[model samples]
Target chain A: MRIGVVHETAAGERRVALIPQEVDGLRKAGHEVLVETGAGVAAGFPDAAYAERGAVIASATDVLGAEVVLFVRAPGSDPTLADALLAWLRPGQVTVGLADPLGAPAAAAALATAGITSFALDLLPRITRAQAMDVLSSQATLAGYKAALLAASRLNKIFPMLTTAAGTLPPARALVIGAGVAGLQAIATCKRLGAVVSAYDVRPAAREQAESVGATFVDLGLDAADAETTGGYAAALGEDFYRRQREALGKVVAASDIVITTAQVQGVRAPILVTAEMVHAMAPGSVVVDLAAAQGGNCELSEPDTEVDVDGVTLLAPTNLPATVPAHASRLYAKNLTNFLKLLIVDGAVRLDLDDPIIADTLVTHDGEVVAPRVRERLGLA
Target chain B: MRIGVVHETAAGERRVALIPQEVDGLRKAGHEVLVETGAGVAAGFPDAAYAERGAVIASATDVLGAEVVLFVRAPGSDPTLADALLAWLRPGQVTVGLADPLGAPAAAAALATAGITSFALDLLPRITRAQAMDVLSSQATLAGYKAALLAASRLNKIFPMLTTAAGTLPPARALVIGAGVAGLQAIATCKRLGAVVSAYDVRPAAREQAESVGATFVDLGLDAADAETTGGYAAALGEDFYRRQREALGKVVAASDIVITTAQVQGVRAPILVTAEMVHAMAPGSVVVDLAAAQGGNCELSEPDTEVDVDGVTLLAPTNLPATVPAHASRLYAKNLTNFLKLLIVDGAVRLDLDDPIIADTLVTHDGEVVAPRVRERLGLA
Candidate 1:
């Protein structure tokens, strides 16, 4: 079997699907690997490294002739690339990468028209067996960690406490509204920076976790037993709940020198936890990091990907923290891609076993048709 | 001492500082309470109710004449109101409410100039005595719960499993990333909805919590011994740890049909867990609720407050889940504010003691000066 790796054409994307070390893994698996020139340059993996790892350098056209094609951001990501790749795709050939199927349903359909079997890596299932192949979780961990750093960097006060010779500097106080990965990480990072951290969660079960992280869990004492869905995500509560929550949370938000809000419901607007009034309640010079800014922010005064000074407080809504640290993010993402590829290729042959949950679940287009039920509906294809 | 409640002026804010029942509590404490007419309209409390509770209803101007002015969103919230109330505020008077001190630091200073001592209820500290006053926690809990509901509403499949005549529709598989308040609530909510829920947290201690919530804890094998900070939050791991973590977590993300990413690090952007590639790998029709969408989302395809279809996957990033259900949210918030008011007013007098940790910590500004060191630094006062 032969595998081709192409450079990512997505703007600001610096990751490669398969790095040099992964190419070596493919070689060890008794498969031939082809690398387009400079595929790994942005991610700090030089072409020479791929060559050293037993990969053959080739042009995009030459690489596409392989049994399988791999990319970081494939076809639907860039129109020009999608057109170029469509011409090169042969019948029964396999293409894999992040294909924006919903954003561009036609792209997957195009692949079908070209008689190419395409698997969108973004659709991988979340299972124990496919843990290494889970790209979402891998990249999210980085985003969570990066959010904390971004907040701290722009924060007015130092995160940690210090007992200086002149006086004992009090530890900065940080309040995290959401207890998701980003919120938890923020709490942890702020704590590490020596800030006195406190966190709040809607779920009664979150108290223990918050406490475990050494942050005092602030409980609003509302009965939200009925607020959860069976799918393990927050269900939208009645308006009464949100009103009461904002009223209760306002006090705590005002006291904190730094406030980081990470509360967002799925398919809904980000909850406005810190209203303009709440922001005013905070002392002058306080800082707020609205991770939900892109969705309109948890803070009323927040603007997406911008910094706003309200009263004396600073509100920061960073658009992409992971991208800020692209070098490491790309490396981690590349590894995830490599792990995913390993599961699809066996003994130098691309195997599409619908019996395998992973393979069946991830295969969006097969036999030159949009076979996935959801994609079919989205594309209005019977 | 006389207490006055004023109507909130901030847009879309309907909560009042005190409900009719709360007014009764103040009266029992031997204080005469006055409320601005229609202050509690949004919370479903009418002026007549306050009158029935032996409280006086007056205009916003008249309400400011009391020794202590209580409000929902006032003073720093409305410059016009702040100006209008200036003449009514006497020396030694105190104003307490969800003041937007961070957004209107100058307004707080103006209170000092008016010879009034202002207590921003939003600045209430998270302490044992102040626990009931912790508004941030209460609102967050509701927001978390509401987030789950929003996800369920927009999801194509039902959350719970049911054995019907047709067959058993297996429970939806929900993956909650981040073990904070919202994440935990999301987990609990999903479980209640009859979904098989799994949760992940960077902090090792969160595993027990995940189990406690009846959700399976997904652990990516990594040395997270140093993952906790003294302040009790999950500390950010080094780049190497993130690399291994992504590799390990990829499998779990791929298996989930409903993936709610709640991972947020404080003051930072939400981590990107579901990359474009990861989304493409998912089975078509799967849904991803990037609770961190406002902070630029955990899913690669998520556009904040927008519903995007990636292949068959739906990426929903609604910004303000709480606002959608403002009724209950306000009620809970009012209760928190009421509880905090009780603590501050002991025997009909406002206490400004710096001895109590809760009080001292929450006193961000007083006597027309920025009192919080951290806040001062943020204002460049230090």
Candidate 2:
């Protein structure tokens, strides 16, 4: 089997599909690897490093010609890149990565029409066996860590408590909305920085997880028994539930020096957890980072990829946070892809086993049709 | 005694001379407090907050007319503001704050000519009695914390180690140069962020302080019995010693993912510890923060108040780090000023007790003469 790694063409997409170490793993498995020149440069992996790891440094066209191509974000993630890659893509060629299959199901339809077998890692099952190949969790971990760091850096005060001769400087209070992978990591990072952290999640099951990370889980007194989807993500509550949740969260948000919101529902617009009125009530010099900015934000005032200042409160909604920490993001993402490839490649050959949920669920477009049921439903092909 | 708080006129200076809490303290001490309108606004204290603390909100003219005026950065710290302030200042009026007496000795000369009895807190002696009045230590603490936060935020990787299914991410290695208050605080902060921290300082005594803050002290085997001045600061080392020190530090600098340089000598240029060659040898995603950038940076490539990228390595030289964290900076600074005020105001009147070293040393100008020996020597007035 021959693997190909191409440079990400999307704007601000710095992550590479496979790093040199991952290439080493594939090469040791009796597979050949071709890397597009400078594919991993932005992610801190030089072409020389790949060459040193028994990977061929080839041009984009030569790399793309390989049997199996990998990407941090497949062409479908960006429409412009999708069209360009579509022109070069051949029938029966396998492409694997995060293609935003649900968000852009039309991209899946196009790949099927082009007779390409595409596996969208974003549709990876949340089961334990498939956890190693969960790109969302891996990337969310980095996003959460970056969110806490960004908030701390932007806030006009220190996070930790200090007992200097000048006096005892109190620790800044932080609130993490949603106790998922990103929010838990955010809470933990804030705690590590010595900030007193509290977390709020719609799912009651998330209370233990949030507490395990040293956050005081706030009970909003809202019944949310059906708040979690089967995919283990926050289900989109109705407007009335969100309205009451916001009212209850307003006081907590106003008291916090830093608020990191990661309340994102899969394949839908992120709920407006932090309203403009809540932000305005926040004390001067407060900082809010919305991790759900790419999904239209958890904070009402947050503009995707923009920093907005509202009444002395700093609101930052960075959509592609993983790109900012590309080195680690690429490394983890490559590892996830390598683990997933183990199931896709059998005996050093491409073999799709539909019986395996991991392979069947992630297989977005196979055999000239959009095979993934969720993606098919989203595209109205069902 | 009427104590006045004025808005900082220095560009990029957001810290106020006093906050509402400090104003309350003065009121309880039976002293009338007058604050210039909007003085503490940038520092997060509204006029209403100040007025609630028994402080009279007044125009700049009314506040300046008070017997004693406090400033975060006094007129002498900024020349343009100095000229404007000099016009309004009256004889026998006592002014206090960081006037940068040594950096701009002429400012002290002008204050002396005007008979405006000014105290420069930057000249405070390193004595136990004056610990609470040490503005340099308080500000340095904030600068160190900010430097670590900036480095962590800018780095392309997370600080802490994680053994996720994606694989283990090793903790980032951080090297901090100079183990003074700022350097030690930076070391502590990086450690809190779970970075593997190592520190290097010219003075051997700094080893204990660095180690206390969870940093492994790196000894370069440089012998200097007189490395520290009587003021307990790093003394000026000639180019010969600096060249050798840079050579010895090259390997450490190259290996570090983050390097925070805080090496500074009082009344002299900071030593260039990290050369361009050393920086070039560092990994592509490395970060170098020069806390001494304002004093001509310890890194060869660092520019004051600028972020410079050299071969994928980020170099930041923030001159006014404390000003960026104005709320707490102002709070701590006000505490230091209030402590110093206890000595200056004797029995509700301005009493210059020249016998007290804390009072005498910080007093830059008194009775139409540059009385401080150091200021007089710097001005060539002896």
- By TM-score, the best candidate is 2
* Candidate 2: residue A63 Cα off by (Å): 2.4
- Candidate 2 residue lDDT tens string, B1-382: 7888887787888999898998877887789999999988888888999999899999888889889999888866765666678788899999998888888888889999999999999889899999999999999999999999999988988899977887889999999999999999999999999999999998989999999999999989988778999989789878999899899999999999999999998777888999999999999989999998878899999998888999899999999999989999999999999999988897898888889999988899988999989888888887
| Least accurate 10 contiguous residues by lDDT in model 2 chain B | B75-84
Q: Poorest 10 consecutive residues of model 1 chain A by lDDT?
A: A160-169
Model 1 residue runs over 4 Å out of place are: A63-66, A75-91, A99-116, A223-244, A263-284, A292-304, A308-312, A374-382, B1-382
For residue A53, model 1's alpha carbon misses the true position, in angstroms, by 0.9
lDDT tens string, model 1, B1-382? 7888888775555556776766777788899988888786655566788899999998866788888887655576555666667777887877776565655666766675777777666555544567567665555554565566555544444455533221234567888888876788778767765679999888878888878977999877767798666645445566676667766777777787778887665324666666777777665446788777755677778887888977556788865454433434455556677676676788777887778766675565677676755445545676
Residue runs of model 2 more than 4 Å from their true location after superposition: none
